[model samples]
Target chain A: MAVQITTQEAVKKIRDKSSVMIGGFLGAAVPLKMIDEIATAGIKELTVISIGAGYRGGGVDIGKLVLNKQISKYVTSHVGTDPNLIKQIVNQEVELELSPMGTFVERIRAGGAGLGAVVTPVGMGTEVEEMAEKIIVDDKPYLLFKPIRADVAVIKAHRCDPLGNLQYKGMSNTSPVMATAADIVIVEVDEIVEVGAIACENIGTPGIFVDYIVKGHSYQERKNVYEELWIATNKL
Target chain B: MSRDYIAKRIAKEFRDGMYVNLGIGIPTESANYIPAGTEVFLQTENGGLMFGPKPERGESDPDLANAGAEPITMLPGGAVFDVATSFAMIRGGHIDMTVVGALEVDQAGSIASWKIPGKLLTGMGGAMDLLYGCKRVIVAMTHTDKHGNSKIRKRCTLPLTAAAVVDMIITDKAVFRVAEDGLYLEELAAAVTVAEIERLTEATIMNIGEWQESEMS
Candidate 1:
């Protein structure tokens, strides 16, 4: 079972220069509350591992950290959505490592499963192949990518039981893999229920993988964050 | 030609029961032109298989998005899985064809789509993987850039997504099939002339004069 904690306490687990895995696809299933707490704490020079850039541009979701200059390095599939991050990357202020979205997900999964490496034919003749080791299996060539694990993982879900069983609504993008690939896993959920509230069949992430659970901002509150951002940018 | 006309032409290449992957940009529009009663399964690299067209405004689900993060809907027998399984279908060569947009394509069919020097790019998402893994690679793009420069180059000056991998190029003005010799002009857009295509193109387009828009149903 996981203990219910405040977002501040959850943020404390992440220190400066720590490598963290964030679960989301453009803010859909990201841990915005914990991320906000970290940004407020002014932690600097962190390494962020994510699937894509934050949604709708700067000062929103993970883009806030990019705007704050808290992240020194980012490993992601794409950064087109955030112009701030793109400017930083262009200026060489922040180091960026690019990966295929599918390979990035599989590398994290390999980390959790205690696997040595993953071999795939996805980037055989591209620059991605140059970054990896090539091995031949049964006379077939494959690019071998190393496993990736983080010091902490912050994830989001629709519901979490007191035992930390997570149930996701729309789709579980990177949460399931990040949950198992980190040393400490913190989950932010919309609602918390009693044990067995989330049936075993419906649980996307089991309680055994969670270290801490936190109640995130309400739906309306979270909505207001982006709403205000849009108004401020005159996009609405 | 309009974007929809390009999509409709590309849609005709899809065979029933073919598992297809559509890349971002102009290739995403082909889903709207799929022939009715065809069982083509649209495989998205972001973990969606057999999805329908983009949803109506206000009906879009943030969670159910395509590779471009635009809201979409799932069709019958559609299943959503993690990224690993999605790429397994891709990298394992299970997909029949994939449609992608290119920044430039050389005469040898090498594609350069992800990056251009001196420009800030969003980085390659899954274009390289699709180019390397799919059985057939169909490139869909406008014939020229905004500056009116030819995109069909003798050699790609930009970083390549993949080399010698493209099977066919379908632009707004023409269709060229790659062969052992070089690019062969197989089809032309409606009312487009061979001389006009030659003037606008940087690569040497061989006119085999076989297929045309009128010959296509």
Candidate 2:
């Protein structure tokens, strides 16, 4: 029951200054073509919610948006890889919120599950404790992280069926939870097949949560991009 | 007092079939010292579990990597899961032990590793979560900072990762275990006298006479 759409059309669902949940860790399993389209469409003031910085180098995947200054705020666990993003944060050109990695993902999951809040002791006495409300249950203190839901979610999958069931080839990263926590879920996939092609056990993101499917860059294209990045960044 | 030596000492504590998480820095080197064919599973917070050794250059798979983004190979029975599930295993207390590096550790066994004031850092990836839920928390660090400041303090001057959560400390100088009695010296590194570590340590080093330098080499 998901509509197949072009990357351009899919990115059009995102509005300026809206929050977007982008799936991936350090550029792995990211919707490259969709992110590229969003950057090209000149979307401004987007609040990007991700786990970490985009790829090792500074001009691919999410890094492109940072380079373009497309992001007004970044809510992620870390941002050391991309120098441009760090510079923007240091210059106050971008507002940055850092969360503990596990807590960030749990908040998103809580949103998807329609939970009120996530209680955990991970940030009990750190800088993160200052930002969250603390609750004590049975003489134990726990930091309460509110659920996070985004206006739109752009995620990448290894493959998908016409019904929008997704399968991830490698690291799923933040895609599955983002798919559920967003008001609109747009998926970028390497291949599309019939509804029954992906087995039930293999389905990662079920069709119930997906709204649109976009054909992403081909394997060869993605490989070339990573290869070029590897050379340029000297990432062993 | 070497990193490898510290890692080897921590590796000895690993039992077969234990699910262990290793933090970046000195804890990552413990991978090299894990006993061969021990069936110990290494869980990287980035979503990899039971991965093989760090891959050689040019043979690295960028996608198959540790939390540190270093390329690694997957073992035969090893599998990769999503980040959510990875944290579930960590936060759910399914991980048996986690070894981490510390910037400061207080007498209360509190750990401060993530940040240093006025310095920019990437942020804590999964260190706090690991410490929050793992069955045992082992800190592997040098006894002193590069400037000769004792990392073992009576109280942490920096921020805290967790309070009274560290179960053990394995420094280059000695091994200390936290208990109701405070920081108890459990073992001393080879050729290191109790007086030598006492001078470098700011916290009260207790039960040194009861501790033995049994396994240190």
lDDT against the true structure, each candidate: 0.82, 0.85
Indicate the residue-level lDDT of A43 in model 1: 87
Candidate 1's error at A149, in angstroms? 0.9
Among these predictions, the greatest DockQ belongs to: 2
B105-153 in candidate 2: lDDT tens per residue? 9999898987776675656767788898899999999999999999999
Per residue, candidate 2 scores C-alpha lDDT tens digits across A1-236 of 68999987998899899999999888766788899999999899999999988876566789999988999999988887787898888789999887788999999999999999988888887778897999999999989989999999998888899888998876677898998999999999888989888999999889999999999877667656655655566544
DockQ (C-alpha) of model 1?
A: 0.43
The residue pairs found clashing in candidate 1 are: none
CA shift of A174, model 1, Å: 1.1
Worst 10 residues of 1 chain A by lDDT: A227-236
Scoring only the A-chain of each prediction against the true A-chain gives TM-scores of: 0.93, 0.96
* Most accurate candidate by TM-score: 2
Q: Estimate the lDDT of model 1.
A: 0.82
How many clashing pairs does model 2 include? 0
Q: Distance (Å) between predicted and true CA of B185, model 1?
A: 1.8
For candidate 2, chain B by itself scores a TM value of 0.92
